[model samples]
Target: METNLTYEAAYKELTEIAQEIENESVSVDVLADKVKRASELIEFCQTKLRATETEVNKIIKQMENQ
Candidate 1:
């Protein structure tokens, strides 16, 4: 199984890829690779966000039960 990437790391990677894509120096041919990487990073970020939301909900439920 793959280790979970920290939100910070994933966000940083996403930002870097966006910046690269924004740069005019980047060749059109490489855009496809960058897009693929960006998609994967997005999925990773979404999974992390969902996990966090579930944890927060659990905490809230526990507090309400007290």
Candidate 2:
């Protein structure tokens, strides 16, 4: 897992993983690892999206209040 992974990078990796799995390119041994990494990327992407959304909303509220 990458400690300093950006949202775009995580999303790109997730997409690639999905494609690989869909294509059945990953062997059984490595499939589990790929799935696990995809899970982590999903979690990271979700958290980043939520935090960005909250920040955007807060900024909007502040602007409205001004």
Candidate 3:
């Protein structure tokens, strides 16, 4: 897992992996590796979304109170 991957990058990679798998284009030799990478990207994307949602909510609350 890369520490510096942005949400967009991870999401793009995940999408590509899904397409490759769906199209049956990935070779068996590297299928496991691609699946693992996809899992990591999914987790990273989920975490990023949650953090963004929390930050946005906090900012909205601040604005409402001001």
Poorly placed runs, candidate 3 (over 4 Å): none
Q: Model 3, range 4-61, lDDT digits (tens) per residue?
A: 8999889999999999999999999999999999998998999999999999999999
Candidate 3 RMSD computed on C-alpha atoms after optimal superposition onto the true structure = 0.7
- Candidate 2 per-residue C-alpha lDDT over 1-66 given as tens digits, one digit per residue, 9 for 90 to 100: 678899999999999999999999999999999999999999999999999999999999999999
Each model's total of backbone clashes:
0, 0, 0
Q: For model 1, where is the 10-residue window of minimal lDDT?
A: 1-10
Q: What is the TM-score of each candidate against the true structure?
A: 0.85, 0.96, 0.95
Candidate 1, which segments miss by more than 4 Å at Cα?
Answer: 1-4
lDDT, candidate 2, at 11:
96
- The C-alpha RMSD in Å for every predicted model, in order, reads 1.8, 0.7, 0.7
Steric clash pairs (candidate 2): none
TM-score of 2: 0.96
